[model samples]
Target: MFPGPTIPNRQPHREPWSRERLMYERAIAMGNAIDSTSRYTYGSALNSYLTFVRIHNFPVDPTEETLSFFTVYTSNFIQPRSVASYLSGVCNQLEPWFPNVRAARRSMIVTRTLEGCLRLKSVPVSRKRPLSLDDLQIVLSHFHHNPSHDDLLFISMLLTGFFALMRLGELTFADNPRLRNWRKVSRRSTVTFNDIQYSFHLPSHKADRATSLAEHAVSPTLIQAMGRWSSEAFKIYVRKHPVLLHALLFGADH
Candidate 1:
């Protein structure tokens, strides 16, 4: 024991961390993050955290400043929805480290991150867009003396669509309530477009992304041929026919 006071045998007081030890210890600790193949994904998140720490000597606490730093750092690059994949690793490890997050409101950023991207699209309304009698006439005119496939489809749509104002999905999809009944009825006689919606309990269709039908409505004869519709069932029918789309589009309601 040295003089001053007989110093009893004592364990050395541990020294505070040095920058060098921090770097070396960080590397050693990173070994834990590495996968069996020595790769880091979940481990890479650990790597990111360590790298962030080494770069900034950040504290071991989740603060608003920490959250801001993370949001800003990620904002450095534009990324796709695959962000979830990259972040799966970060989220797993940081979940315990990060504070609890409350339910967030719906916004463009959340929608974009989840849905990937936005697309400009047009879709038909399911609301009944009843056609005027004159517009019905324009649709009828397309029939001519003889009708082609397009003409027949066009005529069938118009004849049925006028009073019905149906969604394109129900029109195109044969499973429609009216279509199912029409299929059965059409077999009995030459079905008219007017009969499909007016007499039959045809439910209107709705629209959504990856769902619904296009906006364009078809012609009268098309309704009859396609749905085996009966025009006489309608309260009003196109009494005459016109020549072209413009005529129907800009027709004077009779």
Candidate 2:
């Protein structure tokens, strides 16, 4: 009458994950290693390599000679500096498939081909002139008399960008709504102003370059801190304007 040996209750058994599923997840994680723009650039470079191989009836496997030839071919149309970037893109994208792609890219033949392209096809770099205090004065004079709301806004942005060493994109929203990121946008509440001065919170910025009107007049350390520069790279952006140079030699009062 003891119930003929009681049975133990147990949960149902589950199957272990398949290798394919785990690999697929790992592949997705790997893909996310680079940002969207880099992904696009690397993907384009990979596609270009594939197309070259297909059209030339060459093996899909990358080699020193093939990459060198590719470099020379691309250099014919694009700048040699850009071709170097393309090679970097190719290395990043192809390393997963061809473990030795970087080795091939770094080969003497490939490197020399890129250098030859540079020597043959390089052009002088054209950079837009940096804004100066005189430019700010011009803007100020334009809005001196009875500024409208939009004009005031423009002036505010110009002044902030000039003094804070901020980019225009940091101060305003993109014209295309889709391109706007709320996280990066500064809200009105973040800005505070008084008769003497004004300040605002910057959510994010790509502080690659910066210059200050008070360059030589102030401590380099202070300028670096104000610009939130992480390195001395900011020195490269420090323009040697006549006014700043004069201030360096003479006192600020002079």
Please tell me which predicted candidate would have the highest TM-score against the true structure.
2
| Candidate 1 residue runs with Cα over 4 Å from true position | 1-102, 105-133, 174-198, 203-254
**What TM-score, computed on C-alpha atoms, does each candidate reach?**
0.26, 0.70
Minimum summed lDDT over a 10-residue window in model 2 is located at 207-216
Tens-place lDDT digits, model 1, residues 132-191 = 566667767757778889888877766655445454544664453422333322232333
Residue-wise lDDT of candidate 2 within 109-223, one digit each (tens)?
9999899999999997776655667778998998899999999988887787777667777877767564556877777798889999988887864442233335336655565
Residue 169 lDDT (model 2): 73
